[model samples]
Target: MEDFFKGRDTGLVIDWTQMPTYNTIMAVAAGAGLIFMYMLGRALVRDRDFRAEGWALTAGVLGFILTATGLHMTLEWPFATYFPFDNIVFGEPSLAFGVLLLAASLFLWKRGDKIVAAEDRAAEAAATARPLGIFVLGMGLALFGIALAGLVFQLFAAPAEEPISGIVADYPMIEAIFMSLLFAFVGLGAALFPIALRGFSSTRPLSGTAKLVGVVWLVTGIIFLLFGAMNFFTHIGLIVNTMQ
Candidate 1:
């Protein structure tokens, strides 16, 4: 048995294909795995009003997916370095944030069984929450505007009339997808913040959907934005170290 096991270990146990289509399919499969888990959890968990959670408190679950993906990417760096250091650059923080999200989700669950909107008297919050939300809306738009301008200039004019050796090369599809996500995240998220603020600041309680939207935007936006900024610092360090 020892001899047989040793022989089996001699060759690679996981020989992945080098085909791009295969790799894309693998990525999609991994994402589908997470969604499957989310759907399963959604079907299983219930609320006080018998409402099963959709994306509520699913950050923790998403965190777990990220953590797994990050670790896998990091570990498989040699075999899976699609764009060079992509794994190390993205994986570590994803693992950390995943853990943080898990802790936060547990705390929410322990305190309130699930994520519940603070339906405090809107009259009480209106004086504070509404104005604050509007302020946040402006800030979000400002940040998004900067990102948009930077991307536009970088993709268009920076190359002196046409983009060269940049994101719009052979990876136009990837670039398009990224731009779409950016627009959706920043535009939709910024758009929702004020409305959510309105709901939160209303004289009456917030609707369930509104509460969900607000919470998703606020929590997800802050977390990912913070993580992204941290990634910039990490990349700078890498560059400095490489130069040294």
Candidate 2:
């Protein structure tokens, strides 16, 4: 029993059965967010004929699904017992790349020749407010770079632990770093959603669906902020608990 307890403490074993029902609820909520985004994307494409933005939104939705699923698995399953490395490849990178592509599409959509004249006028009018736009684009690029680097690191780096039945072990340091990066990117991406929503609201007269999308984006941004804060607090709590 002592050995089992020690293993749990050291992250050699994880017990998912102990998770509270609230955890499951949060997981479901996260999954719903992803699905909502996806459906919205499809609706936009079909109804509004906005193909580029629709694809971008679809990617963002998929990214959210991966992120939510990863979080759910991390909390609901054994961290060390299952294949942790798979989470990094499928969950982290997918979320990051998806968001990056989404952001890129948005950036281009806003600045492409089709809308360049309008965007330029908007830019000139809000020159000072435009810093946020630049920041969003920069953060999107950074996230893509980080995702690429993580993928490379996963490919060439030594396994953190021996594979069990073909499942690769999770490296604590790598997992921590990747999660941190992911959360950072998500937070920034969430911030951009509200900004884009506002832009859409101001410049173009959106139909009922677009209005709903803006509201959803705002709400999702708040949820992502909460999620990021929870992750940060959990990490801090872990460190403090370890010290004791």
lDDT of each: 0.41, 0.42
Model 1: how far residue 195 lies from native, Å: 10
TM-score of 1: 0.36
Which stretches of model 1 miss by more than 4 angstroms?
1-59, 71-82, 88-100, 113-174, 177-244
Ten contiguous residues with the weakest lDDT in model 2? 157-166
Candidate 1: tens digits of C-alpha lDDT, residues 81-147? 2333334334543444455445434544553332244343233323333555664465456536544
Cα shift from native, residue 120, model 2 (Å): 12
Q: Could you tell me how far off, in angstroms, the CA of residue 232 lies in candidate 1 after the best superposition?
A: 29
Best by lDDT: 2
The regions of model 2 sitting more than 4 angstroms off are: 1-113, 118-204, 242-244
What's every prediction's RMSD, in angstroms? 14.1, 14.0
